[model samples]
Target: MEILKVKHLRKTYHTKKHEILAVEDFSFNLKQGEFVAIVGPSGCGKSTILSILCGLDKPSSGTIEINNNLKFGYMLQGDNLFEWRTIYKNCLIGLELENKLTKENLDYVNHLLDTYGLKDFKKAYPNNLSGGMRQRVSLIRTLATKPDILFLDEPFSALDYQTRLAVSDDVYKIIKKEKKSAIMVTHDLSEAISMADRVIVMSPRPSTIKNIYEIKLTGKSTPIQNRKAKEFADYYDKIWKDIDYHV
Candidate 1:
């Protein structure tokens, strides 16, 4: 089912001297359980599109239609966990702020921590965890809200290359296992191809859709395994060329 639809989306910014257009003629649809990734050059407004979709900011033009009763979860660039709080408490913070710290919700959070290998460290602070473990905790925090559609903005950008690979695969599995639809914005073409069901390429600056590719791997599985697919490199090259990086 189509859970979200965006039509002719445009966003502009105002300054003392002039107006700047951040996005231009953007449109896309996100279906249930679909993993979509948006990639473009730096400052191409990829993150801007995410902010608009998640209602953090308003678009200057166009409309976004979402299925009724759908809630959103966001995982930003860094893990953004507090050093002072235990991992379990960090996960519950969202529910606490939303006034949803009920018994049922508490049980769900515990289940996520246990299921995702964080049960042993629930009482540990964020500073003691490895980078990958920290990212998992961050994901659990986002999932704690029980959101239907999750928006990820450069979610693995802060990690080192090896950790980035492992964490991305882990995250891909977590999102799929939870059966949540996701729209991720990243500059890494390989990451986008390996992690997404579909990859949308955007133009630089005043962003617009340049191309969208439906990824098909021979034995499509985890993001890491997907890297070895026969068609992966071809898709990467095509997307690399389609991106307007030089402009």
Candidate 2:
């Protein structure tokens, strides 16, 4: 099932003296329960695409069809959790805003917290948790809304290398376990290769899809493990060369 479809997507920023096109003729369809990663160079309008999809910004010309009857949840580069809110409260923020904070929803959030090793820290403040834990809380908050699609924009870039790998695995597992679909914009080729079912490489601004690689592998492995898979280096080399071609 196709959850979302984009046709001839374009984003043009109009300014006093110039109009800059960020993305042009970007079109794709995302299937249900699929994880798709988009990679591009800096200033290639990665965030612009996400913003337009989320209705935070309007595209110059395009059509986005969301076939699902669920809201879209966005996770930015930072954790985006309110520092003053406790972990549990942070998770409830979405529910509160949507006026859907019922006991059932709160219980579901609690279940996620407990299942994810955050049970004991529910009452703790965000400042008390590690970077990864904070990110988990942020994801829980996004999931609390029960979105049909998740938009993640480099949510792990702020973490250290070791922490990023661990958190990437955790997040990948959590999303799969929950059976949620996601579209992520990332510059990390390894991260994109490890997390996405398909990785779409884009050209510089105005960004356009240059190539899309379907990652094929055997067995479930950690991102680090996936990186070391026999076929992993082949993908890395191929994607590297592809992106380099655009550069």
Candidate 3:
């Protein structure tokens, strides 16, 4: 089932002297359990479109149709976990701020921690965990509110290359295990090809969809394992050329 639809999306930045067009005519549909990754030139407004979809920013001209039953959760680049707060408390912060920290919601958060290998570290601070572990906790925190779809913007960019690979695998497993859909904006072609069902490639500054590839691997598993798929490099090369051509 289609869960979200965006059409004719465009954003413009107005300066005192002139106007700058960032994105134009971006359109796509997100399925109920699909994972979509978007890649483009650095300043092509890839993140801008994500911001509009997740309600952090408004599109100057567009239509976003979200299923009434779906809710959104956004995870930014780094872990951003609070150092002073315990891991459990960090997860509950969202529910607390929204005044939805009921017994049921609290129990749900606890269940996520226990299910995702963070049971022993509930009381531990963010600084006490490895970079990969912290990213896992950050994901649980995002899941705490029970969002139906996640909007990720360069989610693993802050981690070291090794940690980034491990964290991507961790995050992919978590999202699949929870049966959630996601739309992510990432610059890494390999990451996008390995983790997404469809990869959207956009043009420069006045961003628009150049192409969309449906990633199909011989045998799909975790993100790391998916990297070894027979068809992986082919998809990567095509996507790389598409974006490279635009650049």
Candidate 4:
């Protein structure tokens, strides 16, 4: 089933100097349970598309139909955790704000906390945890809202190389285990190749769908392991060339 659809989407920013066309004729259909990655050159409007989908921004022209009744939860480039709140409190902040707190909801939150290795650190502050743990908490907080779709905007970009790889694998597993659909905007070609079932390539400024590549691989592996697959380099090389053309 189609969980999300974007038809002829366009977004333009009006400025004193000129009207910048950030996104143009963008369209795609996302399947239920699909993890799709969109990659492009920097300043190419990848985040614009994510922002519009998450309802943080509006597209100047187009149609977006999200099939589910639940709202989306967005994760930005950084953890965005509250310094004042404890880790557990930060995770439950969404429920408290929505006035949706309940015993059942709290129980569910506790279950996620324990399942995702945050149980011991529940009382700790965000500042005490490592970057990866903070990101995990950010995701758990997003998940606490019971969102039907999740929008991730380069959530792993700020991490160190080794931590990024491990965290990417962990996040991938968590999203899949939770049975959620995600749209991730990233510039890392290997990341796009590793975690996505389909990789959407965008052109430079005034971005549009350049192409979409289907990835076929077997077995479960970390992003690093996935990168080591025999066909990995071939896919990498092709996407590298495709985006290199625009750069």
Candidate whose TM-score is highest: 1
Each candidate's number of clashing pairs is 0, 0, 0, 0
lDDT of 3: 0.92
TM-scores, all models, native as reference: 0.98, 0.96, 0.97, 0.96
lDDT of 4 by residue, 1-247 (tens): 9988899999999999999999988999999999899999889999999999889999999999988575798899989899989999999999999998999999988999999999999999999999999999999999998987889999999899899999999999999899999999987899989999899999999999888999876663666678878888888998898898542
Candidate 1, pairs of clashing residues = none
Q: Which stretches of candidate 4 lie over 4 Å from their true place?
A: 220-222, 245-247
Consecutive 10-residue window with the lowest summed lDDT within model 4? 216-225
Tally clashes: model 3.
0
Tens-digit lDDT track for model 2 on 1-247?
8889899999889899999988987899999999999998888888999888877988889899888565799999989889888999999998999999999999999999999989999999999999999999999999998987899999999899899998999999999999999999998999999889999888889889989999996764667778877777788888888777453
Tell me each candidate's RMSD, in Å, in order. Answer: 1.1, 1.5, 1.3, 1.5
- Could you tell me which residue pairs clash in candidate 4? none
Candidate 1: give its CA RMSD in angstroms. Answer: 1.1
* After superposition, candidate 2 runs with Cα above 4 Å error: 245-247
Per-residue lDDT tens digits of candidate 3, residues 116-146? 8989999999989998889888899899999
